[model samples]
Target chain A: MDDARLAELYERYGFLVHRRCLQLVRRPEDAEDALQETFLRVKRYGPPRDGGATLAWLYTVAARCCFDLMEKRGREPVAEESQLAALEERGDGSTEDADRRALLGAALRTLDGKTRTIGVLHYLDGYTQDEVAAQTGFSRKTVGKKLKTFEDRIRQLFAGRSHEARR
Target chain B: MTAPLPPSPRGPECPPAAVLEALSAGEPTPDATRAHVQACAACGAQLEALTTGRDAFLRARPADRFLRQLERREAAAPSPWRRLFPVLAAVVPVLVLVLVLGPRLTGDGPGVTWKGEAFRVVVSRAGAEAVPLAQDSAVKEGDRLRFAYESPEAGHLLVLELDGRGGATVFHPFEGTASAPLAAGQRDFLPGSVELDDAPGTEWLFAVFSPRPLQAAPLLARLREQAGRAEPTLTCDGCRVSSLRLRKAP
Candidate 1:
């Protein structure tokens, strides 16, 4: 597509771009950055006329940007044993931010390192699970199992967090 | 053609998040998802939760306003796109923000006053003319001095700016109200308001907008052309204006 047509597509897809990024990036401004970067790529390499793969392709670019942005911030949200330990020591927000973070953290910590990475890069990043599997080199079956597990853990974690926050 | 959002499904007896997502995507939903959303409590809560988020995020966002400005910008912007025109694209949105946020945020150009000997000129878009309401005119007890207009589309201003100085020079960029129509061949009596500190001769200008050291412009050309030099005046004899010997370039 031409730049104008690409821009039209970009605008139409902005909300999804933003929401998907928000779950992983933890900040609205960062999500906006990811979105801009996504469009900048689309601008550089004209997107497909197929349109079906357009969102998937955009998601891949955004996924990479998220990793880069995370790396830039030196907050690679990996599930190393040490990292999981650090998560347990969590900060003092104790409010919704802390509570949400803790639930997300516990759920994230439970996944195998690769699985967790895929889950965050997909659901949290707004990538389809298939795209996540493709980017991370996981089988689609593995990615699906990881996401379902991730979801269950998160539900329990958030439920627990909500209970704690309530008290 | 884009299809309407599917009827909502239920989970948790509330609307579903998926429904909003589908709607946001401007896509059609499957019958199962729609039925599930309408009856499912969990899905219903998800919908409410997501809708609330959408409302908060999109609501807090000046998106609607920005979208309108972008529309106007696209309309007015020239085809040869350049990265350097960020400032130009921003003009409409900035104008919309100021108006939506109220006058204090806008700094100046809300109300400007010029005292003509025969009448007082207050330049604000209140009446029809797409022109400033003239202070000196056949004022009647109910005659309003001016009116404002906001172009329906965003790019009008860009095109306005490019359409050349005359038309572009006379815009109340933020004024988005309806325009008052002047009669057929009815000469425009008063152009709008005059600035006290403009250089000694009149310079035809569009409404000048700025925050610091706000000033007004003479509506002479606009006035003369509006009504064919029909000495714009006050409707009442008892009324008084600040000054009448307005500095004329002529």
Candidate 2:
């Protein structure tokens, strides 16, 4: 795409991509690096196949870039609770909301890489089952099944917390 | 009093997770799924939670330094034509002259004699155009010698000059010298103004067409030593040698 179109794409979705990167990388600096790389790759390879899928496509690219960066640092894919808490303390979000995100991120860590990617694409980022399957190369039936299991696990986690608080 | 929920048969509550995702993505939901989401308070609360998380994440803006770096990348990329223009400027005129005069510069014609070798050469002075050199034709120092010639056959060409003071100069194919290939019947000039220096006496010009490209620098270096000792004997394999003498005005 030309610079005008690229700039327009960046203006519209750059923050969304940066946010996704920050969520995965858990560091603002690393997230910024991931955001730059994601747009550069988009410019080089052209945008996603479907223009409507721009945000979803950007989500996938940002996640992979963050994952690769983490791997290069010889770190695990598991979210660092301390770093997330530190970033949350920066006041980008409310403490309660940050706590909820930290819990959700911990929940995501419990899933395998493929399942976690599928979860992020299907749930928080709001891609359809077919779109998630297309991006993750999973069959729609498989995505439907994994998402069911995922939702049940979250429900159980919250239910057990409720039970413990009640006791 | 609580309002009644919209009437619809919900199949397993239509997967509230998918409905929530679709809603947040601004995708159209199945009518049944929409009905269930409207009726179910638990699903509605979950959708709000997901939207809150997504929106909060999107609040992070791309830093200013990143945009500036992209602008710098665009500015650093060189335009393709800019790199090719100078090469074209130097090559086009020689091509044009070859195309315009190729048919007329036959190697056999009235020639000039020097050291028992005859070579056809057309000479003109700096303000004179296409004036053929004749007996007693003389030019002063600082006057440009506009000489044109062709080879009898296709080969590598070199024009070497020996001044009256026995200094050897390579007059073709060096830096700032532009000429054409020695294809039979292809006419070319020694590019640009080739002015005569103040060595006032007889000067010999030799044009050699060789089967292979000659290295003029080393040959000229050796010629300089011989030029100071005696009349230099120069040789090249499969070379056609021709010569002319020009009178330098005293």
lDDT of 1 by residue, B1-250 (tens): 2121111222243323323455445556677767776676555555565456555655555444434544554566466556547866888788776545543343223343223222223333345443233422222222223322222222111000101112213322222221123222222333343222223332222322112222112332333333322233211111111223222222
Which regions of candidate 1 fall more than 4 Å away from where they truly are? A1-7, A48-57, A76-167, B1-20, B41-45, B48-250
Q: Which regions of candidate 2 are displaced past 4 Å? A: A2-16, A82-167, B1-22, B25-36, B46-250
Residue B168, candidate 2: alpha-carbon lDDT? 77
| Candidate 2 interface RMSD, angstroms, 1 decimal | 11.7
lDDT of 2 by residue, B177-238 (tens): 32236667666654654667899776766676665677776556656766643345454445
Tell me each candidate's TM-score. Answer: 0.34, 0.37
Candidate models: Cα lDDT each = 0.43, 0.59
